[model samples]
Target chain A: MLERALNGGKLYWTWIGFLLAVFGVGFLFYLQQWNVGLGITGMSRDVSWGFYISQFTFLVGIAASGVMVVLPFYLHDYKAFGRITILGEFLAIPAVIMCVTFIVVDLGQPYRAMNVIFHPSPSSILFYDTIVLNGYLLLNLLVGWTCLHAEKKSIAPPKWVKPFIILSIIWAPSIHTVTAFIYAGIPGKHFWLTAVMAARFLASAFASGPALLLILALIVRKFSKFDPGSEAIQTLGKIVTYCMILNVFLLGLELFTAFYSGIPGHMHAWEYLYAGIDGKGVLVPLMWLSAILAAVSISMLVFPQVRKNETLLAIACVCVFFSLWIDKGFGLVVGGFVPNSFEQVTEYWPTLAEFSIAMGVWALGFLILTVLYKVAVSIKEESGGEAIH
Target chain B: MKIERREFLKLAGLSAIFGLGGTAIAASVQQTPSYIPDPKELTGKRWALVINMDKFKTDADVKRVIEVCHTKHNVPNIPNPKQEVKWIFTEMMENVFPEQQDKYLTEHYKHMPFLTLCNHCANPPCVRVCPTQATFKRKSDGIVMMDMHRCIGCRFCMAGCPYGARSLNWIDPRPYLDPKKINPEFPTRMKGVVEKCTLCYELIAVGKIPACAEASNGAIVFGDLEDPKSEVRKVLAETYTIRRKPELGTRPSVYYVIGGMKDAGKGA
Candidate 1:
């Protein structure tokens, strides 16, 4: 039975080919990072965290958004979401995996990521985020797999899995909030120095992350046999639209407070992002592109017709995902570094070497997702083997 | 062939139903800690600092404190910008804030160095927020300090500091120090760790004044804030002093008396 389940789907050698190419490129970049240290990456004294960390920061939100969907389905017995629950769990696994990899790459000492466990700092939020992120990953993985094992045998998932789901349900936002606390707890980086920053972060995660997932749903619908309840997809899209609007509102509030009050410390980031300080002209087109994409995506999502149309929906989803990714990845990270305490506009762009290494980390994440998804899909397909090719 | 995704509907429903209850549990535990080892010893002293910015008259004086502090500590100065480290470095606010550079201060007193370092806030946020126990506030005193080897170079502390006081060494900081210019009094910092002024910990640990205090030749006052008879306490009592951004409510331990007009004007 297990062999029949596993052997149903084609091995997808094309995917394997793509994965290897990404991995090879990534490997070459990783070598550069290993030999030279972070110098090969664009980081400096004032803006310490750059490409690696920005990706980490953005992905943590994406990882946490898995729960935004998870909470509704498993814990509440939302029958509509039964088909999509595996995607959430598995997507979470990759998001969390990516999140972890980003931190490792960003660290001046990748090996020392473990010292958080060995030499624990109970006071630090990063310590707690580390703990919760790992625990959350294990919980989702264990719960998801336990169910998968039952699915494989055509049996009911054991009652023991309930506790893991419940723990994970509560644990998801904790991971994101702790991630936010890593920034919000700081007293003086004006842009980051807000109690609401965490709230804003989660809000953006809910909006942008779900948009990414819904977009993924459309892709799967196109390339795969998974229908994954369009009603559920539309419902999640509505949630993303609602959250995205709120996120934009909060961003407006942030800008008003900084610029209207005329606090240079607070306004410095705004200028760096929108206006381009010291004529760096660096974040100029990127920030505008992000804003326009965000607006169009939100608009597309607002209308039922556009949301239902797969091609259009995919376009909207891609735009929103890229928009938020650029905002978080480039805007926020580099923005914080600007008007650095020294008041110099130190610009950072990821070199080909850095970008390639980043691609490697991302490829590694995708590889894990691919394997996990393959196992999950095969088992699910066996339960209803008549539909898929 | 199928790209089957296990749709996470049930989990999504679960979180929405009880997300707040989870948040409430989190809310109860969310009271974060601060690095300021504020000894609750109910002392006659709430710790404070009194800086005579005027006493920083010459570049040599500013250089003296940095030199002594760097030497006393093993602060390496690697030449690359990534690794460049400093236990004490001069920051021209004009240099640091050139765009906001005003004519009032620049026109009046062209080259007055604020000689800034870690304000060591009574609310030292850096100590509590460092994940690997790398940065901490000394129990005996409120001076926030760092342990370099333990630092993972996460730089979260740098992000959290309200004062913009913390710095990260982006490269090998040890190679850049001018050997002859290297001050033998204090230690230097390494790359990757966040570091700032320790208020001359070893100096104060011994029966001596801080390097900055010594350089000022009685211009800058240093003594136990706890001691009623201490000179710092006396200065605190006598003068109407100011701190760098009291609005942030960081409760900076470093106090300042603005001899120059540019002093209080830097309200940011």
Candidate 2:
């Protein structure tokens, strides 16, 4: 079955072909970034972090998506995720790869990324983050591959595997939470300074990330016989609902504190991000659109009729993921920069070179995800494992 | 039920050991700490600013400070204001009397320009939030200084600061200093890092006055708060003065003695 799938043109090459073309185009873009440096991106000194950091931020959520399945399978012993759990773990591999890529490209000296290690400063949250993110990546690859290999041989996983899965379950939240600490730990940027910022980051990540997986699960079901089933998608859907609710609620708390305080230093960030401050603002339209879409998607999740429908669920998932991506990734970072210490606004636009490098990194992730899913689907089909439904 | 007391004790000890062993393998997880400025630095002469808004008036005064410092420090350019990275910027705000802020400032009068720069606070948020210790406070004199090479251009310090004193080099700004001229006193920064006033650290080190003080006609005073006889202490003692954002508790060292703003009273 594995040999047949690998040889079958209709089975997988189409995806491989399409992904390659996109990846090729994105690679060309990255070349321009390599030649010119970050100056090519739409970023300015005022908005030092632009799209690349946003991509890094958004992809961390996607990488953390593996936890949504891991937690249920290990914690609750929900075998429903067994058939598709590998997909989540494999998705994380490329996503983590992309997260690292984005960070490297975003740095002033991409070569010095190793300096983050050679000169480790525990006081720097970024220093600790490098350890957690890479460690989580290795853990996922080992556990997911080891389990899948055992399944191919028709044997139970090693006893050691149990502890690893249990650990990864807790480790998943740690990834997003540490990513949150990256923002929350900043002292004066009032928008990011909130204590709930980490909770909010996880809440939103779990919501949007699982929502994306549900969409992927549905697309797989439609295009291939490897459909994981309605039961799994719906279970994931419920996770999205609970998370999106908490996520949106946290955003509300932020706004409440921002306006209520009346501190210019605090209120100004909100104004610059959503409303434009002192006549210079960039994120207004993108932020507003994301907010509206997120609200609509939340309402759709709440209504059972809409949530249960596969088509509506997929649409809602994609919308919610994009909405949260813009909010968490682009807006959160850029918002921190505006109405700078002097009450002056500076403009930062990502140059084409910057945008291209970002695109290339994401393409690399998609390419890896496509190949991993194909292998998982082939194994599941051959083994006749219980359908996820 | 009373079969073995020794066995019971052994069982208890074994459970405790296993519990500790199990938890040891678990990942060490710690939530990020809440940001509270250390008072240890502030406790000993937490130097602060008190601004006198009355003295600064006229373009000449502003120019005098700019030039005196510009010549002294080789502060590169005067031609293009956009290319200029200011050590100090002057501005004026109408006095908000009955409200005393430890770091607050009155506006720069055409007759009086309120100078603004790094406040060198006891609780420097910029220092605490810097991911890299590129920006730090001096141990001996309590001045905040920046190292350009180490700056990753993350700009978190710029965002963390309440005062808009930090500036980013949006472009390669060095050529404005006249391609031929170079000053070793203040190293020009590469693009993408932040730069700010160092309170003329080199000047103070060399026993020279801060540029702003040298430029002014006795308008600016520089001295040690630790020494009551220092010129600054005498001025701070004789005149009622104000500090910006007294409520935030930054403990700024710059003092202001705005004439009528004493009715404005940051003096207390």
Candidate 3:
């Protein structure tokens, strides 16, 4: 199973090379940041978090999305997902890694990150986030590897792995919830002070996670003789459609509450995000674009004919995934900081260096995803294209 | 192995016991002290600061208070307004007390500047949200405290603070600091940590009043709010003073004495 990743086509090798090169450039920027401090980033005292934290928030959702596959396959006994559950779980491993990396890079003292464990404050949501994230990472790695190894050996997975898989199912949603709590629990940050934050996070994650998975599964099916099966892909598309609809509906609910109440605290953040506050609409275009893409994607997903066509399905998945990415990755975190505590408009935009470092982290995630997917695919291909079940 | 349910349960139970035992041992081995002094001991004192705006005569007098605080605290004098480190500074009355601003107020009252700093809230969200005990409210004095050495600089504390009180050292502050002008006894801060007004804890510890209060020429009053006979208590009892964002329920220890003015903006 390990040796399988060693073999790849010229295109595969080239993709890996491109990712590594991006990683190298990003690493250099990280080194510069480490040397001069976070001053190199566009973050200020007003907007203490910018690109890094937003990415962290988005990736946590991606990490939690693995549960969509695991829950259906294990709980409902959905047979279609058997071939790709390992892929979803493996995807979580790197996604969680990216979440942790983003947090470390955002920290002013990255070296002191161990202090979360060294001196834990249980009251802090970040403390819970650390515990659940690391625990989820381990759970996925153990369950994924055990199942894959068992498949390669042409035997049923050990009975012990069953309990852990169930645990993973329950633990997956907790990661995103805990991450949401990090924002939602803050008092003065009106943008994140909603009770529905965790629900919204989970809904978007369920949609975006499987949508990304569908894209990758399509790529795998196209290039390799092994097919993850149309049934699994279509089932995942249904999950994405339902979750994304819920996500957009929740966004509308947030808008209604903010505007209906007309509370300055609640409405100011929305104003700054959508229409701009004090004549500064830096994120207005991005937010509108996300909303439009979300609407179009949902419409495509809802129609049976559009969803049935694999190409249309792929495009819909891309739209949902990218739309949610903009909503979470750019709008949520930065919008929460603008009209800061003083009700002053201090806009934040990522510098080239900052964006490059982000790219580096993404490339790193892809590099890990490539290796892990290759291994999983090879094991499945060797085991006659399906798990023993 | 095809284990039965009973056998699997037994194995899980054994692992659980060992796991619990391992955690207990590890916890005992790393028995670190609590980050702040016990709240039980804090009942002896609850520090408060009250500023009487009526006593304030000139803008230079306010500047003197700010200057003394910065000099005493050895706060870096970064020339850039965007990156300056402020422990205590003056803010326009309209900006600082937005809710209290009045349209009918005289020009003198309209443009007047008031001193501002951390409220040092009785119930501080910053202390509550800090991952490490880097930001803690002192139980004894009720003053919000920061231990920069322990701060991981995640800025959660900054987010948690409602008043925009905290500032992160975005760059190494030493390069911008004037060594000759800085207090020799007060230590400068390193980059990559959140810092703010500590209410001159060092001065308080030495039985001297805060630098800002000492320089305010009896305008800024400092005493124990819990003490019924203290000057701060007396000022609050006799004067019509207000705290910033009191509706938020942070119970800020700082109070302002506004002279016979009404919030005309609020249909006065």
Candidate 4:
């Protein structure tokens, strides 16, 4: 099946080459970061975490969203998702890989990363996060590979694979939850201190993850023989609509708590992100763009006529993906650090080196994703278009 | 030398097991001796500091305290405020105690500089959040200590701290140090490690106080919080003192004595 990926047309090879080139350039920047230290990035003593960690946070949500498809298909016995469940799992593999890579790149001492394992502190949420993330990655690879292999053989998946599938389903949510706990349980970071953080993370993840899966499903439909079923795509759009609404509602709740309570500590972070504190508003415009996109996406997605229209659905998915990308990937992490512990504002903007390194990690993820999806789609195509499942 | 394949395999497996077991036994037997406290070493149940702001009347007074501690600790003198590293520094009173400030507050209090450093909290969030116990609170005395050698430099401790106390060496700090002024006794830090004031634990081990306290004339008091007779306890009791973000429940060991004028005339 992997050999099918190796035997792609000119366009497929060109795409692979492009991703490799981007990855190679990013790796060069990463090597420089290793030598010069984290100071090469725009992070300061005040805003310690920047683009890399934020990307890690957002990608974890994407990885966890695999469970959205897995649960409905396996537990509820929804036959519509039967063709797309493997796509969800394959997406997870690369998202988790990117999450782990972002973490490694964000570390000041990448060489000492093993210290997290050698001297594990159970009290640390990060320790649990590391365990759950790696565990989720392994689970996805095992389940996705085994199931795809069974499909290739035109047989029911082994009895042994059932328990592993169920475990993977349960393990998926834990990864994003632990990632949220990384910020939520911190002592003085008021923005992340809210109880709704994990919920907000899950909501945005469910919305953005399926939105991406929908876009990919459409691309697969256009490029290959596999359709992923019109019913499955429509159902995914519905899922995205409901989750995006919930995500926006949760943000509204946070805003209410911050403003209504009139606590300076509670309000300051939101003010810094949305309105700016003392005229330092680097994130203000980006946050508003995220808000407007979310509004537009939700409005378009809620209408059944628009969702049924393939072209509108694709546009909505793109809007949801980038909107959440800006919100969770950019605003959330940076917002928590601004008006830094001293009640003094210190804005952060990633340097070109940080952006290049980050772009490299994303390209590496997409490259892996391309290879995995190629194999999965080829197997589906070989089995005479969805009959094997 | 002429053993069969199966026999050779059995011998190799047995030797590997014995080799591992022997190494384990040797390691257990060669364990490092337990630390012995020197007779002259300063011992405390819980170490604490009291910064008497009234005594810090002049700018030079605060500067000297920061200089002495940073010089002793090999803290970098990076020109960029964002990347700068320091063991101790000063902040305006309003910024130091934002919750306590109001428009009508006296100009004397508003403009005053309060010395700041690691609180070495009783409930250190940095220690709790550290994936590796690279930063930990010492059991002998409640001083938060950082093991630079063990830190993976994840910077979780920086986010965990509410005081903005910790700093990561963003670049190799060696270039920032003045070779002529470098203290040969103190180890210089490498890039990609988080460091902060350890309350001069090295000095304390040899029966001396923290560098900041030693240089502050009478403004900074260092002593055991558990000792009722200690200078820190006396100052804290006689004056109205506050810790940074006390509501967060970290129980910071460093206290600021606000509005106390008993030693206001003192100069470094």
Candidate 5:
């Protein structure tokens, strides 16, 4: 399978080279971050977690999205997903990898990462997050690889794989839920003090994950002999549409609870994010853009005609992906720290070093994704279409 | 390949149970005590602080306390307000207790700065959320303490703390120090760890009071809350006082006596 990854078209090699170049630049910036410590970033005593932790939070949702396909296929026997379950699992691998990298890059002392493992605090949500994330990563690797290996051999997957696949179905939700707990469980952080956090996280994840997968499937169709099949793409679009709707509804509930309750603590972060608090409105425009895009994307996706049209569907998926990214990746983590415990608004915007390091991590994820997708697609082509029954 | 189908299923089932069960057992074994202590067990020392608002006659009084604490503890005097590391400092009443702010009395309370520091809460959120147990409350004295060497510098404790007491050394603080004026008695902290006021735990161990309390001219009272006869206990008994964010239920040890404006001519 790895050998298949070594063989790719000129476009594939060029893409890899481009990502590597970006990664190289980002790695240099990381070295500087290491030397200077976290001072190089925009984070302060007030806004401690900046871009890195947010990205990690967002990517955990993406990784957990694999369950959307897993549940529909394995539990409900949705045959259309059989063509693309490998894609979801492969996407998760890189997403989880990127999640771990973001945490590493964000650390003030990367060398002390092992301390979490050696001294596990069960009371801390972070300990559970680390456990579920690592477990999910291993489960994906085992299940995806073993099943793909069986497909290559033209045989039923080993009897052992079924159990792990079932376990993975249950495990996926735990990763994002625990990640949400990292924020929601905090005492004084009012922005994240909601019961629906895990549910909202899962909704956005289910939407964004499949949305990204649909876009990737279109790319696969354009560039290769393999067709991920119209049925597969259409089914995924439907999944994205429903999840995006749920995500929007959940967000509305959060807004209503904050505004209607009129609790200053609950409304403070929303006011800061949506409208500037005390005249500092760095994220206001972006949040509005996210809301507008969400509405447009959901409207576009709901119509069967637009979803049937490949180009329109692709456009809708892209909008959904970016909308959720802005919501979860940008505002969610940073906004929680606003009105720091003393009720002072200390804004955070990423510095060049921080952005570059983040870009480098993103590039690394894409590179891993590209290699895995290449191998999976090559296997499908070799097997004369979709890998297995 | 020759193994029976039933045997394979049995083997798979057993392995799955053990595989998952083993991790659960290991995590349980490695677990530390919950950050929340048994209230009944907290029988010995219950250190508390009482800041008399009436005695703060001038800004220099608060400034002097901050200077001594920062100078002794090697807290970096980062010029940037955003990146500053403050262990103990004064904050205005409106900012410190927003809920207690009165629009009609705003002008009168303009200069009222509450001496704020780590609450050393009975149930400290920072200690609960620390994955490495780097920040833990001392069982002996109920002082919330941080182990810099063990800290992973995750800043989870910073988020967990409601008092805004914990500060992360974002960079190596050594460069910011005046080497000629560096305090040799206490160690300077390195970058990438959370730290806060230990209620001057080291000085307390040596039968000495905290520098800020000593320098406060009887304004800051430090004594065991459990000992009813102690100065802090007596101050609380005699005066109407308030704690920061008591609604959050952190049970802060620090108390503030907001004496009436009519008593402005007299000091505590």
Candidate 6:
């Protein structure tokens, strides 16, 4: 089954080559960062976390979103999702890898990262996050691989795998929730101090995760014989629609609480993100662009006519993916740091080396995703163009 | 390849015992001896600092205190404000105590420079959020202590602290330190560790006080809050003092005596 990924068309090999080139460039910059320290990045004492952490947050959501397909098929017995559930699980494997990589690159002492495990602090949310994320990754790998391997043999998946599938279903939300707790539990960070943080994270994750899955499914359908079924794609589109709506609504609630209450601590971060604070608002234009994209994508997704059109749906997914990327990945993390502990604004923008390192991590993830998806799709195509359940 | 039930049971039992015994040996090997306090150490139930803002009469007075602490600690002198790392520094009264600031506040109160350092909170969020026990509060005297070697430099503590006390060594700090001025007694931090004021724990171990407190010319007082007769307690008893962001429930050990001066002058 693994050998299937090794044998690919020229286009596939070219794509792989492109990703490798990008990864190589990024690795060089990462080496520079390793030598110089985090001072190579734009992060400061005022804004301690920057691009790397934000990417980690976003990718965690992507990993958790695998539950969307897994839950419907395994728990609710939604037959349509059975075709694409493996896709979701395989996507999660690479997403989790990327999340861990982003965190490692962001660390000032990447070698000492195992200290979290060696000297475990249950009091810290980061400790719990480490446990859940690695657990979720293992769960997805086991469930997806076992089921897919069983399918290749044209037999029912092992009965023992069912309990693991159920566990993965429950474990998915815990990963994102623990990640949210990392920020929400911090005392002085008013922007992330809201109780709704976990809920908001889940909403955005569900939206962005399914949106990316929808886009990937479309791409897979175009390039491969595996259809993934139109019904499955439409169902995912619906999931993205509802989740994006909830995500926007939760964001609106946050805005209302910040503005209506008129709390300086709460409102200051919002002001810094959307409007210039003391004439230093680098993220203002990007934030507004995210807002416009969200509104446009949500409106387009709600209409059945637009969603039924594959071209229109792909555009909507792209919008949702990038919009949420900006909102959660860029805005949320940096906003919390902006109106810093002293109510002073200090802007953060990733340096070129930082961007290169991040891009390399993304390329590594995609490289993994391509190989996994190739194996999964080839197995499906071999089994008479329909996914074996 | 099949083994008899009796033989399988024996093998399993033997491996289990060896595994348990190996783990016990490893744990014993890893165990570190407990610390013994020096007899000459200045003992306290809860060490605290009270800054007499009135005593800081000149800009040079505040600079001298900051210089003494930074020099003693080997804190890097990074000129870039964005990447600057400081154990103790100064901020205006208005910025330091934003909750206390107002339009009607006098210029003397508004412009006064207040020394800022780690509060070493009684219920510190930094200690709570640390994934490893890199930063912890000393149980003996309630001083917040940082193990730079243990710190992974995740900067979670920086976000957890409300007073902006912690600083990450963003670059190699050895180059930033002057060779002649480098303190041999105190360890200079590496590029990838979070550090902050240790409240002069080293000095306290030798029956002295914090470097800043010693250099402040009576502006800073250090003592045990648990002791009723301590100078810090007497200062708190007499003067109207405030802690930064007390509403956050961190219960900072550091206090600032506000409006205690008979003759207030322009701040530097």
Candidate 2 lDDT (Cα, 0 to 1): 0.71
DockQ, ranked from best to worst? 4, 6, 5, 3, 1, 2
Tens digits of per-residue lDDT for model 6, B1-268? 2357457556556655778554554444357467877778999999999998788868999999999999998988899999899888888888898777688888777877788999989999999999999999999999999999989999999989989999998889899998999999999988889999999999999899998999988999999999999999999999889999989899999999987785444332
Which residue pairs of candidate 3 clash?
B42-B140
Residue A157, candidate 1: C-alpha displacement in angstroms: 1.5
How well docked is model 6, in DockQ terms?
Answer: 0.70
Model 5 interface RMSD over true interface Cα atoms: 0.8
B1-268: candidate 3 lDDT, tens digit per residue: 3357457556556655778554554454357555663333323287888987557667789889888888788778877555567888877777677666679876665677878899999988898889998999987788789888889989998888888888888889888777778788888888889999998887776567888888899999999898998988888898788888887778899999876334433522
lDDT score of residue A108 within candidate 5: 80
Off by over 4 Å in 3: B1-44, B80-82, B100-110, B260-268
What DockQ class does candidate 5 belong to? Answer: medium
Task: Give me the iRMSD of candidate 2, please.
Answer: 4.5
lDDT for each residue of candidate 4 in A111-200, tens digit (9 for 90 to 100): 899999989999999999999999999999999999899989988888898898899989988898899999999988999998999999
Tens-digit lDDT string for candidate 5 (A1-389): 78988887788889999999999999999999899889999999999998999999999999999988878888888887887899999999999999999999988889999999988998898899888999999999999999888888878688888899999999999999999999998888989989999999999999999999999989988888878899989999999999999999999999999999998989999999999998998999999999999999999999999999999999999999999999999999989999888889999999999999999999999999998898888887777555453
lDDT of 6 by residue, A1-389 (tens): 78999999999999999999989999999999899999999899999999999999999999999999999887888888888999999999999999999999989888999999988999998998899999998998899899899889878798999999999989999999999999998887899999999999999999999999999999999999888889999999999999999999999999999999998888989988999888899999999999999999999999999999989999999999999999999999999998777677889999999999999999999999999999999988877544444
Would you estimate the TM-scores of all the predictions?
A: 0.83, 0.81, 0.91, 0.95, 0.92, 0.94
Query: Can you give the lDDT of residue B27 in candidate 2?
Result: 24
Question: Candidate 4 at B92: error in angstroms?
Answer: 0.8
Calculate DockQ per candidate and list them: 0.33, 0.15, 0.50, 0.75, 0.61, 0.70
True contacts kept of each: 0.65, 0.22, 0.66, 0.88, 0.82, 0.85
Q: For residues A1-389, could you state the per-residue lDDT of candidate 2 as single tens digits?
A: 23444654564677778777777887787666555444556765345567888888888888897898877777777988876788788888888889888887666544545655654566767776788899889889888878777766677788888888887878888888888887786654567778998888888888888887888887777766676868888889999988998999998988888788776667877888788876777678888999998988988989889988888988888889989988987888878777544456776566656666677787788878776777777666666655221
State the displacement of the C-alpha of residue A78, model 1, in Å, after optimal TM-score superposition. Answer: 3.4
Model 5 residue B94 lDDT? 84
Q: Of the candidates numbered 2 and 4, which has the greater DockQ value?
A: 4
Chain A TM-score for candidate 2 is: 0.94
